[model samples]
Target: MTVEVGSPAPDFTLKNQDGQEISLGDFKGQKAVLLVFYPFAFSGICTGELCSVRDDLSSFQNDDVQVLAISCDPVESIRAWARQEGYEFPLLSDFWPHGAVGESYGVFSSDLGFSFRGTFLIDKDGIVQFLERNGPGDARDQQGWRDALQDLAA
Candidate 1:
């Protein structure tokens, strides 16, 4: 039940690793958002995918876009993970409502008590421009995201 393309991106206010509140709607009319929903903070596949985003952050954070990674991990764990990985992007904590944000996006798994690997590229207008979800233990290729961003610019 991942949110479909052309749908309005849901709005949410969640604490980042730094305990700062961030909302999706804050970016509207400013920058497109890359909302990444992952199961955990320090897991293997999750780390790899986010690191790739970290490695190419400029491409994602120029005048038009920004990346925000969300997970069910507590803010403390997220803080440690972000500090360890040198991730400058916001790593939001969905632990208060226990994955409610991911659930709304159709990525949370009640059975597993976590979220699948779901990525949504939302445009400045709050419309979902691209969407992809992978089951547990699966990896994601980030090029598709870049291609979609290119299309958005075109």
Candidate 2:
């Protein structure tokens, strides 16, 4: 089952593109987390969606908010993609366990060997405040995310 809003988010530790360990709990009591799970690093829809986030990074990442994008791709692939796209935010790799974190969030597709587009907004208290999932090929509207962040701020 998918993780629901109002439930405690499942904490995880994964390597970022730089190979640095990043844990969900590290942001606890500091900033709200926008956890984004994408299917692949260089795929078209994923790139577009993340490019939008990169373009409006300040809105998604700031003192009170942090965006962490995860994919089942290897850290090397994600590192190249981040470098090529000039993304300032962390692009995490869930490749070692092959979508373990995605599975925990109920977004992983075992048959497809990747995750669908799943976005979760987790507050500093570790409670999920907003959740949205889109199937493969379905583009997400980031306005909803902005609205959720605004609500959290309020």
Q: Which candidate number has the best TM-score?
A: 2
Residue 106 Cα positional deviation in candidate 1, in Å, after optimal superposition:
0.5
TM-score of 1: 0.96
> In order, what lDDT does every prediction score?
0.91, 0.96
TM, every model: 0.96, 0.98
Compared with the true structure, what per-residue lDDT tens digits does model 1 show for residues 25-124? 9999999998989889889989998888889898776778889999999999999999999999999999978989999999999888998989999999
Error of 2 at 75 (Å): 0.2
In candidate 1, the residue pairs with backbone N, CA or C atoms under 3 Å apart (3 or more residues apart, or in different chains) clash, namely none
